[model samples]
Target: MSDKAKLVLGDKTVELPVFTGSEGEKAIDITKLRAETGFVTLDSGYMNTGACTSAVTFLDGELGILKYRGHSIEELAEKSSFLETSYLVFYGKLPTASELKVFEEKIASYNDVPEGIKTMIKAFPKDAHPMAVLSSNMVSLSAYYHDLCAQDLTPAQKDEVIVQLMGQLKVVAAYAYRHSQGLEFIKSDGSLDYCSDFIYMMTGNKNVSKEVAKALDVLLILHVDHEQNCSTSSVRMVGSSKANIFATISAGVDALWGPLHGGANQAVLEMLEEIKNSGKDYKTFLAEVKDKNSSSRLMGFGHRVYKNFDPRAKIIKVACDSVLKTLGVKDPLLDIAKGLEEVALRDEYFVSRKLYPNVDFYSGIIYRALGIPTNMFTVMFAMGRLPGWLAQWKEMVEQSGFKICRPRQIFTGDTKNTYIEIKSRS
Candidate 1:
């Protein structure tokens, strides 16, 4: 096999070195391609680009595989808590018993945000989106910890910021949810585990059931990381400019706010609601989804990355069922969702296209069963995804020979045009 790829130009030939990942994924090293050949590859939507190498998470979409720090998602979801999974994702190893205790304590200690931040949350309109409020509060953390946000930091300071962000983000999310309901903020309770504490704060329930909390923990673990996703990429891109961690993560929150990303779960719930309220049966509604000319669309039946079934979806489906049963909450939307899922799974139109159920499919069902409003779903996603964003940002900054992320583009517009004076325009 050749060690390099030969690229031929009009009268020039260049040999680009080939690099392979540990998993045998191969890429042509293009670092010197433009320098040598004066030509650049155009990958729209970055569909074929590998921006940077990472060890945080490995995903094989075709194989339906996802792992963090080399631990399978199935194993982690079954045996690990959200905080432990977070430690593994951020620090690249499962903490020792004592190390885990210290990590949890540090995060619990940083859970409380400044009182002024609560005041800020209260000032947003009652109908304001929680994501907007959450992002605002995240960036504002820089105001409280200026030293930690500096470009150069001691190793201890970096560790503190990581723990601090992980702890405070849930509080901010809870406060944002409370503010949306025009309710008073609930202070964090260090006595409870991370997911239980978050549920308590969000719902003002001190005695949250163990089953519910564990379900939430599994969901968070599933979302902790995926390889170079939109929001994770946003974090790395913003952090590359030497921006503070708070601002960089805020960029991720904003990116995740899009309907096509973290908001997909919320959209899934909304689609179910629409179907239920339309008085149409699941089979009838799905017919519209299959129609090429119909405006109706399926929100969570497929994924962009996973050519096979989504591994997270399988785990969360069980959790979703368990939580709904544990709470004894009967939501009509769940019936509709199940009906759609059953048809989509066996229907030739869907099966042939591999449009299977994804993580977003059942997550909103679980969130709704827990009494979380639809608007708050993405905020929950952001909370779950924070560790991944932090790890990516931390990895990018600490890497040797790191460069600012500046993507090249092929412009498609008028090359040169004279500006017309407004008064003289005919």
Candidate 2:
């Protein structure tokens, strides 16, 4: 095989170098294509583009494989805590006992968010979206803590930023929810673990069940990193401009609030609620979903990337069950969600297309069981995704050759035409 891919357009031939990743993933490096040939490839939705090469998370959608630092999701979810997985994702290695201790201590040290941040969350209306409040408070951190944002951060300074976000993001998430509920803010418990502490802060109770903490820890580990998804890309894109850490994350929080990204779980819950209120059985609704003429569709049945199954879904599905059993909570929406999963898995229409239950399918159910309201689901996702965003931003900043991400587009409109004056236009 040649070292370059030759693209012959008419009589002009272009040579684009090929690059291979550690896992044999191949891409034709087109960094110089437009510069040399005065032409650029068009990839709509970036469906066929590789924005950046990353070592943080590896995802194989076809095979339903997800790994972090070369460890399988199953292994990490079962054996590692969220903080441990976070350390691995950022530093490229699991932490030693002493390292883990120091990391935990660092988190504990920075756990308390500023009074102004608490005040900011309270300022939002009671019915305001938690994501909106969360993003506002997140960006405010940059203004409150200017020392953490350096145009060129040293390794220690970068780590400090990462640790600070890891420490405070959960508090912000929980506080935002409380403010939405018109409840008072709760501080973190020094004795609780990371996930447990967040749960305590959200509910204002340090006494938490063991099973609940385990379930949350596993979910966080599963969400630690995904290869350049929407929010991660948002972080990298905004950070390319040398924005502060909080500002970049604020951008990500907004991106994740979109209905297509981190809002899937919220949609799932809403769909379940809609189905429950429809006065029809799930089987009847499932038929409507299968009918092409009908407008009904399943919310969490399939994924955009995973044609087979979502690896995270397979892991978190069990946690969902465990959480339901542990809390002994009951809801009609959960029953509908469970029934939909069972019937869809067996139905030919679903099985043929591989539209199995995805990660978000049961996540909202689990969140509901834990007493977390539907509106707060995406904020929880932002909390879990914090570490991944930090790692990706840190990697992009540390790369010496990285350029600002400026994607090109083909112009389809008329050019070289004089603009008509507003008064003369018919």
Each model's lDDT comes to 0.89, 0.86
Model 1 ranges with Cα > 4 A deviation: 290-296, 347-349
Q: In model 1, which range of ten residues has the least summed lDDT?
A: 295-304
The candidate that achieves the highest lDDT relative to the unseen native structure: 1
Model 1: which residue pairs collide? none
Residues 1-426, model 1: lDDT tens digits: 687999889888899999898788888999998898889999998887999999899898889999999999999999998889999988899999999999999999987899888889999999999999999999998988889888977778889988999899989999898888878888899999998899889999989888888888888899999889899999999999999889999999999998778988999999998988888887888899899999666888777778789999999888887888889988888888888899788888888888888888999999887778899999999989999998888888889989999999998999999999999999
Among all windows of ten consecutive residues in candidate 2, which has the lowest summed lDDT? Answer: 295-304
RMSD of 2: 1.9
Clashes of 1: 0
- lDDT per residue for candidate 2 within 1-426, as digits (tens), equals 677999998899988999988888889999888899888989898888999989999888889999998999999998999999999989999999999999998987777788888878787888999899889888999988777777878888888888888888888888887777778888787788997888888888787788888887887787788879999999999999998989999999999887677888899898888887877777888899899998657877776678888989887777877787778776677778878888888899998887877778888888888878899888888888998999999899888897888888999998889889999999
